[model samples]
Target: MTVIDFTAFIGRLATASGETILPFFRTSLSVDNKSSNDFDPVTEADRAAEAVMRRLIKSNFPQHGIVGEEFGNEREDADYVWVLDPIDGTKSFIAGFPIWGTLIALLHKGTPVFGMMHQPYIGERFSGDNGSAHYSGPSGERRLSVRRCASVKEATVFTTSPLLMNPDDRARFGRIENAARLSRYGGDCYSYCMLAAGHLDLVVETELKPYDIAGLIPIITGAGGVVTTWDGKPAQSGGRIIAAGDPRVHEAAMKLLNA
Candidate 1:
């Protein structure tokens, strides 16, 4: 068995992803509509970034499995699998927003063990593996931790789309909003990266698949954050995700969700 050194692999993936995304950062490209909604957009940047990562993974980890947002599953039953969301905030990237990023995660026997989120446009890379998370960029490397906010009233919260939630879910999010110190929208994968970097407190949302949360789990957990479902269970649940700087903050957010 080829035991992958997750820490080193994450550094390589970050470098490769950044190299793939930089050229397309602000270039005017034809955007394709994935859905009738204006918010559902995909661009060449998204495809190209994923393609690059896939290519690298195939070359380096030929035996590993892969699942990507742009590209579907391949070799899914392998002992090692990679979950990818290249250009995670496609809409934001297409609209010239800097919130987009490349997300990569490695799963060992169905458990996430390593992850990296690279914002190529901003030259920021957040990496985590083996219970430790770190941020790298022009500023340098720094460890991250989630906030220890004991109450929702003192928490800063974030979500991708309020519109994607159903009426009841929206109401639940509203209750969370009411309890939070502040709430914001439109961060996408970048929000989770911020959480890993200790800049954000909580990120709650519904309708996330394995790919969406896989890469984020290691990063957040490595940074001393708790990632779980809104019901306070493991985040591997397909329903919803709630990420917080501290376990207490996650529990407090859970109370608001179940309220």
Candidate 2:
């Protein structure tokens, strides 16, 4: 089936996952550390939301594959795969921040064909299909577009936290942060969506999984922006990602990042 046919189903997945997660937001939720060496937090909301989405996908498209952050992979070799990060910003969620969102991506033969970031708390949904993007929520619905920004000196950039990056990556990112007109942190998936919506200029991140980035690639590209690795590779596999609203800015940032 075509990607268009999956749009409604994606909406359903977003809704179901959002509903499953909202109640846990800002509550006295128990968190589990998924990493022994680091603070990789996962809560019941993350697992429950993913479980709901997984069940829906399994029942609706039994033949499709699934890759999730909370759970392990299943049928990963199938032609159609769904990548999910039920709470893309679990850190923010745990901090009682509304910046977290549910990330859903559909891969056609390993290429992202559809993506959406749904924030139920803020009631915002950002969706795309590589060719175009749209935003819907309390502010109403509109087409998503990136604003023009030609240079890092004139740009606003964001990253979840430089602390998340290792020493070398952090040093490279510091170059961009120092050059940019503004720098902020702690958005996770919401920062990428804001870049898609013309509100931001650049987003640079490192140490991301497929589930962390697969859903964001189409949204940024579809909104007339660019997303890629620091060395200019596709970002679906998710490592050292850099996204910018303008190609010139992207090129400029890439040079700085690689230098």
**Per-model tally of clashing residue pairs:** 1, 0
Best TM-score goes to which candidate? 2
lDDT of each: 0.82, 0.95
For residue 256, model 2's alpha carbon misses the true position, in angstroms, by 0.3
Predicted candidate 2 versus true structure: per-residue lDDT over 49-152, tens digit per residue: 99999999999999999999989999999999999999998888999989899999999999999999999998999999999999999989999999999899
C-alpha TM-score for every candidate: 0.93, 0.99
lDDT of 2 at 130: 96
lDDT of 1 by residue, 1-259 (tens): 4335556766677777778777777788888887785556777777887888888899988999999888899998899999988877877887788998788888888888887888877788887773888888889878866667777888889999899898999999999898789999989888998887777789998989887788888889988888888877777424688888887877877888887
Off by over 4 Å in 1: 1-4, 36-39
lDDT for predicted candidate 2 compared with the true structure: 0.95
List the pairs of residues colliding in candidate 1. Answer: 146-245
lDDT of 2 at 214: 96
